[model samples]
Target: MYAPTPESTGSSVDDRPAVERLRHGDRDALTELYQRHGASVYWNAYGVLRSRPDAEEMTADAFLTLWTRRREVQLYGVSVLPWLIVTVKNLSRNRLRANQRRTADSLDAADPPSARASAEELAALDEAMALVREVVDRLPAVDQEIFRLCLVEELTYKEAAAALGLKHGSVRNRLSRMRTRLQSELGPRS
Candidate 1:
């Protein structure tokens, strides 16, 4: 869904020669490609992650991936920028998910649950979680992915849209409808 246009890289630069040079173990070709598209790739990562350090790291990782996966890299038209964009997008999302897991683990470790909680309370919590999962499972496949990316993964609307290749408004509207449906199904909290 991400069609590569002449403006995607801010120029009509052909990357075939550079890719060929890279595939032949030419480090200068890698440097050339980086100089050509590094900013676009970094900004793409930053747009998704909103963190300078993470974006910089992801930018480095993206170029590394391009280097390591040189033999397998696929070019769209004459430019390798599309492949780099997709790589950075994936790297940014992975970083986000890992950070989310680390935060959750740290929080859990910081605040051990009170052992004095009643069995009834634990059972109620389990039941509510089960109901939520069941409701989410009933959604269409794309909607289910949207839910996971937006809610469970905590990606911004723009990030989710870029990952899912949907428009920003479309992701926002679908998520709103999904929440409304979920609330209606679950009813008000007592």
Candidate 2:
């Protein structure tokens, strides 16, 4: 059986060696550092973005930041985990905000307020449903489901929350955000 030692109990001792190596511009040392704290950084990004590919990219960017900023970083307690987590969070937010900007720009709610679709355009529920699907699909997965349930399906907020294993307030809030996005895209209702 393996036994714990002073070295095995904490990150302080183990991390110092890798940090020292990083100070020397050693790629292997950066790899070691990533292996140690990569999951924490990835989780930080994933928790914010909720997408695997984005999280993976965020993790890589965080480690790259660590390598680029190695000489500038002061490791007060011998671990770079905190710095990595902060980097992950900042990058993830930037990516998410950029995506929102793209979505908002793509919306192009620029038609004159008085403009209206022709009766031929409104001949079928299929057209309206397709439009709703296009807007809702732009949201994140959880938000898409919540909006579909609470709005499209006409489920009560409480019922949707229960069905989706979320709090009532959470369901309500997401629905509110969904409404805001649609309002911005389609303009205020008459």
Candidate 3:
């Protein structure tokens, strides 16, 4: 619900001549246009954005648009407020869209994965796993047995150690070294 300002309330002369003056590069006419319509433009943008800084920026852009496109200036009856309001709406929408795009870009970068894996990611993971298996298969005999028992069979370190007649700490240390080697071979995760 927009309430008209004091300047907007009383009867005023037609603004077409001022617009025409602005078309002829009259800064006074531009200033007059701002004096007449700036409040409406600022408030319209404020209504949309609910932030003083954004509203002020939109207000400036709206006036800059008027100055840039002065040659094509048109008005409804006697007031430029309607044109300013429409320009503010368009500027506000554009700012909102840009902000949303930036926020979405940030979210995408942070998340890294979608609801499902893409073809490229799945193929890369498969390739990485194949390389890991190759590395495991090439391990020393005892190391290979420990890797299989601890990882493939999902045994606890203590359980694997007991089955293989090794100390629990030795089994843990071996598994840690194997994981480090695997990670180095894999390079980096996505």
Q: Order of all candidates by lDDT, from best down to worst?
A: 1, 3, 2
Candidate 2 per-residue lDDT over residues 46-66, each given as its tens digit: 999999998998798678667
* Candidate 1 pairs with clashing backbones: none
Candidate 2 segments whose C-alpha is farther than 4 A from its true place: 1-13, 109-190
Candidate 1 displacement at residue 123 in angstroms: 43
Provide the lDDT at 133 for model 3. Answer: 89
- Work out the TM-score per prediction: 0.55, 0.51, 0.52
Q: What is the per-residue lDDT of model 1 for residues 7-123, given as tens digits with 9 covering 90 to 100?
A: 546368888999999999999999999988998999999999899999998898788778766887878798998888998988798778768887987788775466455889889
What does candidate 3 score on TM? 0.52
lDDT for position 39 in model 2: 75
RMSD of each candidate relative to the true structure:
12.2, 15.1, 26.8
Query: Which candidate leads the pack in lDDT?
Result: 1
lDDT tens digits, residue span 1-190, model 3: 9787656641365778888888999999989878877777888899988889989987886786677667766777876677778877876765665566667776887753565788998998899879988999888755775786677555667755654546899889998999999989877666
TM-score of 2: 0.51
The per-candidate count of clashes, in order, stands at 0, 0, 0
Candidate 2 pairs with clashing backbones? none
